[model samples]
Target: MENNKNIIPEKSGSKYDLLLKIEDIIKKEYSNTEGIVISKDGEMIYEKYFGESNENQKTHIASVTKSILSILIGIAIDKGFMEDENQKVMDFFKEYDFIDKNEIRDKITIKDLLTMTVPYTFEEYMEPLEDFTRSEDWIRYALESIDGNGEKGKFKYSTMSAHLLSAILTKASGMSAKEFANKYLFKPMDMEEINHNDTKEFSFDTLFGEKIEGWANDPMGISAGGFGLKLSTRDMAKIGELYLNNGEYKGKRIVSEEWIDKTLKENQNGYGYMWYLIYNAPIRMYCALGDGGNMICVIPDLNTVIAMTSSFMMNAKDRIGFVAEYILPALSN
Candidate 1:
């Protein structure tokens, strides 16, 4: 691939040099890694792909799909498919009879689900698939699977909450979450090489020697909003660029800037919608984090964005700290 020269700064500073070194280190340290670092303005400052980019080489991206789900919700709001964050989730499910008649479920708002505070215990409901054939009816399974716990607005990290958000978006848009994402989010960004892996069967070794199939086999299947997205490293960077640019791309305003701001602003768990806010450092950065260390880190202060994908989901907190400790500080110096 040809490099874009104009995007490269004329006077490369020590930060640039340090980033190069870090890139080299990462390639040597990690196996099957694809990473890119871009300036806030959408310039690729650094890029490296170590393993492969073929069909079977796709990165599962785990929870990073949550960020894409977040954008779809924002688009739904912008298009009037959804009224606002406070809109009742039950309102969107007019045709679905599986939803409980309990007032608590009706009272659960889009905001509650987005923030993972749906006032329900999601753990008992979060069992792995017993077999590939059992992985049908993901939505009903998720809804009925919930173990009633706390009141709405309480803090808890529940995968089922995100699953419900995906279901709501699907109901409102009259399309699956993947379809909506392709039309509204990916297409506008020129991200054509993306795929949603909600339905493929694979197995991984669990801690206790139990063989577990990929979570994609859950009854909710691929539409599980919290995870199950797959994309190229460059495309992932483009997502960060969209958020960094406040929902605009190449003079096109894809989503309202107000929605972008609202999505990044801190909420429960320092989480805005499906995104996370990290204000602990000298700089405030909002990021989309996934399992296996897949991340799109957006540093508004430095006008920078970093996207990383690795085979092993490990040490994301430390990696983010590394950016704060080395990457940005070197850039500023």
Candidate 2:
């Protein structure tokens, strides 16, 4: 069982036995990876953990939270919280633009934020991330950061800019993003309850808690959209499962099939809504990838969902290779 790491096995096959051989390789190679969960044809066939981690432990999941936020955005649309993804960003936050000083901000749509094509004042996405997260009013902070620069449709990615979406969701739903997520997304999917981070200020420890479940928020109580979500390895798989089932969980529709079809299709960039679409892989799939090896991959053709998490590190994108090189080929056989 590879040092007692394999946590669950609902079913198995020759491919699973083959996949098990690579477990030791993954453990020795990706030393920081905390957990891995794989499911095929709707049954969880394998679950494992490493380095003092387990199935219930919630990793920070970093920017993978962006993809989950995208699902919540779809749910918001399905429930009629906002007219559509094409709605203007400024329409929800008149307080941020009372003077109407930024004409470009008025034209920024939710789609621009999802695709990360919205214009920004900073050249590097990290430039404003810390300052934006620490601000007393982050929604307004994110709003003021948008600039015309005449690059609205150009794909300039920013974690801080994505908070605009959480703020928009807050305004549209008349509840905090966490509340909306709990009511519509998490609960419906049977995921563990998610609570707000106690402090308005961000903390790494809150995310690393073995049992403490939390989602971060700005001082204004808007949930962080670009980052700051703590999810268990299996719960992340549940998300992939939800998408693989076309936005239904346990036969109940959570997000529309239309939303699922729209969000999974490759866009102009490699992004599908907030998901990173991968066509070069052994299978055509999409991923919610985060820093240091966190991922939720949905391979529709294979009817597979894979979820994983790791301690904070730099080789985060390597999880994609874990799929392309190992998981998909094993499944194909």
**Pick by lDDT: which candidate is best?**
2
Query: Each candidate's lDDT (Cα)?
Result: 0.67, 0.80
Query: Model 2 over residues 1-333: C-alpha lDDT tens digits?
Result: 333555345447777677786687786778788888988888877778876787777788888989989988999998898889999887787665355476788898998898888788888445566576566777777777777555778888878656889888888889877888899988888888786555443545443333325877777677878777888899999999999999889999999999988887776678878889897776689999887888999998889999988778754458888788877777888
Off by over 4 Å in 2: 1-14, 98-100, 124-126, 203-213
lDDT of 1 by residue, 233-273 (tens): 77778888888888898778888899888888776478887
**Once superposed on the true structure, which residue ranges of model 1 sit more than 4 Å away at CA?**
1-11, 28-32, 53-58, 94-101, 122-135, 145-149, 193-222, 314-317
Overall local distance difference test of candidate 1: 0.67
TM-score of 1: 0.82
What's the C-alpha lDDT at position 324 in model 2? 84
TM-scores, all candidates, are 0.82, 0.91
lDDT score of model 2?
0.80
